[model samples]
Target: MTPDAILALYEWVIGACFRCGDANLFVTPIDAVVTPRGERYPLAACGGCVLDMEEERRRFAERKGEKYHPGRLGRPPA
Candidate 1:
């Protein structure tokens, strides 16, 4: 994947962690993901809290502006 794609993935993961409300979560920030890709991927999950998609969306909407709706990103009416 391109650098941008990787960084996007990391951002999504961090957002997921934040939404989970797991204070112990530790993830490589977006800035650090700029490094050259090595033999392994640079993604990790919160050991304490289980990641939930619905919860993430709810939390994201609360913090981000109302324009942050994910459904709008889906395919539009044909």
Candidate 2:
């Protein structure tokens, strides 16, 4: 799903962030996912949510302390 991030969608800049469910002032980075059947649904994720996700990911990585790294494309490096 790729969201077409826009500051204003039809002159509206307030919505719920998919991650935190807060009043979003910046209608940016909205995730727009398209279903296989050609249906589109906007997600709830603001910039703050993206940061939060990144932080959570970093913490998770720290916990695992992985040494092996996968290929850039997730496949084994040739």
lDDT: which candidate is best?
2
Which digits, one per residue and each the tens of the lDDT, describe model 2 over residues 26-65? 5344457789999987765555555455456556667889
Please name the candidate that would achieve the greatest TM-score relative to the true structure.
2
Candidate 1, residue 47: lDDT: 26
* Per-model TM-score versus the true fold: 0.22, 0.43
TM-score of 2: 0.43
Candidate 1 per-residue lDDT over residues 1-78, each given as its tens digit? 333433333333343333344544454322213346554323333423322332465477788764333322112422
Which 10 residues in a row give candidate 1 its minimum summed lDDT? 69-78
State how far residue 5 of model 1 sits from its true place (Å). 24
Q: In model 2, which residue pairs have backbone atoms overlapping below 3 Å?
A: 3-32, 18-44, 18-45
